[model samples]
Target: MHLSVENLTFGYGSKPILKGVRIDGIGAGKVAAIIGPNAAGKSTLFKCLAGILKGTGNIFYDGRPIEAFRREEITKHVTYLPQEGASNAVLTVFEAILLARQFSVSWRVSDDDLVTVSETMEALEIADFALRYLNELSGGQRQMVSIAQALVRNPDVLLMDEPTNSLDLQRQLEVLSIVRKATKAKGMTTLIALHDLNLASRYADQFVVMSDGMVYASGRAESVLTPQMLEDIYGVHAEVSIDSHGQTVVTPMCSARNRIANRRPEYAQLAV
Candidate 1:
């Protein structure tokens, strides 16, 4: 097993949010997405996987309990990039990424770590802005730096929160493309918490939708993103259609009350 979490249960103080969560089927080279509304425990679940926050039940990576592993040990295997606001960085882009060496196999970075960092920067296409201060960069640029730092660890599992929060449509898709290509190239596993349904459907190899602090559905995108799911989770009626290219699109329609009020039954019959 690449990574596995069996029966993960966690909460704040006495309030339970996640109960008996199991994630044993994960494998290498797949990008898994965790999607939910605001305050639906998405980030909490990520912290549990990262072992930054403690939780009940089994949480394993490479067939070992994650909590049992040393912090440095786990750091070498997994990396989590929280949202941009959490970054207190005053360093330049290159400097911030170089800090990733702190979690190295050795206290002092070997030649390999240096090479990895350089290569990751290149792969992320941030080689040009390497010397720029993170705060001075645009939101999109800052996010790229953050990603470069996370990937510099060369981890087996990567967890990202709102990876496309501050980006244009082109940059958003560019980042997603980079993520997919890199993870596949390295055979690494990735989990991203996202809010955009269209992007999630387009990119994620697997989808886990959370509702009311529980998994509403977990499966392939086509299997998971049903019209009923939209209705139940988003509280909207939508028509789900797939084009000839097999890409699914959700066309959310107005509610029944609005539709009825806009088109009176008697008036419609007379027009016909």
Candidate 2:
């Protein structure tokens, strides 16, 4: 599947959040990371793509406009995982995952549904928490369960917002690995909103950098994650270097605000 966005615009009342944002070349079996500074509209963009927010734009999946699909049809092809994972539902982890899978099935849950939920839980290493109440699990555990819920749906396009948030180092790696593996195996188009540049560079095959509600840059990490981009978009001085494993690593040195203030005195207050 190919996912493309063009002239995407959205906002609340008079304040605009996205301005004619366009991204392309995100196809099946590929993981594209959406990176940007705080309040850069990353989450808003994901919401628009997932049909959670009504926005004026063109979103195409597999060369067809997303607006043409019915609600149920869209659900079959797209699964979105938001940033926060806490659920007040009284259901257990297994029940939550099973409910997600059951959305597509008209009949009663069968042996296959149970097996699929079990397999997804195991893949996420949350099988032990199957019987635990969702409200009782810790933040990280709930996040893992939320991921399992998304995976069980087996959508063609997976839109994840900060999927690794609240996770420890080990769990972070595990979640990303599982996502990458699943994307490749099922040829799914995965768009993940990530705050960590190094982690994004390590896992994503492509990068889309957003700034001020628009696309600042898009392409391979090495090409897009340059020192200049760091200074321009993130207002930070950073070093982008290839690690021993041949992966791109970003190390922040200092705030680029001082440098910007020196160059553009009119906007000096941003430095503070």
Candidate 3:
């Protein structure tokens, strides 16, 4: 499957948020990182793609307009894991994941569904919390359960917004590695909204850099995460280099404002 968005324009009432956003395409079995500074509309873009928010534009799955499909039909092919997970649900972790597998079922829970849920929990290292209620778990645990829920659905496209949020460094690496493996094994088109540039560079096959509700850059992380882009878009004086593992490393030296202020006395007030 191929995913593409063109001329996407969305706003909150009269205030525009996304202005003519366009992504050429993301092929199946690939992970694309949606990266940007705060308020760049990364989360909003995920909502529109998942059909949680209706925006004016063309969203196509394999050249077919998403608007042409019904809500239920769209859900079958796309699954979205939000940044802040829902903890209000009273269901146990196992039940919640099992329920997610019912999107295409006919009330009867098959052995395959049970196996999928159990395997997903195991894969996510959350099987121990199977009987625990969602409300009882900590923020990080709930986030893991939320990831399990999305994966059990077996969707063609997965949209994960900050899936590593609240997780420790080890869990961050584990989760992303597992997600990348799943994308390849299932041929799933995955897009993740990430603030950690280094992590995105390590895991993502492609990068979609967002800025002020628009695509500032999109391509390989090595090409997009340039020092110039860091200074211009992120307002940082950064050193971009490749690690021994061939991952792009971005080390921020200082704020662009402070750099200018140090050289030009007149701009000191702005930095202060």
* Model 2 / residue 265 / CA error / Å: 15
> What's the TM-score of every candidate structure?
0.87, 0.93, 0.95
**Residue pairs whose backbone atoms clash in candidate 2:** none
Candidate 3 weakest ten by summed lDDT: 263-272
Structure candidate 3, residue pairs in collision: none
Q: For residues 1-272, what per-residue lDDT tens digits would candidate 3 score against the true structure?
A: 79999999999999998989999999999999999999999999999999989899899998999888898999899999998875668999999889988875467898999999989899889999899898899999988888888888989999999999999999999999999999999999999999899999999999999999999989998899999999988999999999999999999999998887799866766668
Candidate scoring better on TM-score of 1 and 2: 2
Clashes of each: 0, 0, 0
Best by lDDT: 3
What are the lDDT figures for the candidates, one per model?
0.80, 0.90, 0.92
**Distance (Å) between predicted and true CA of 141, model 2?**
0.4
Model 1 pairs whose backbones collide: none
Pitting candidate 1 against candidate 2, the one with the higher lDDT is: 2
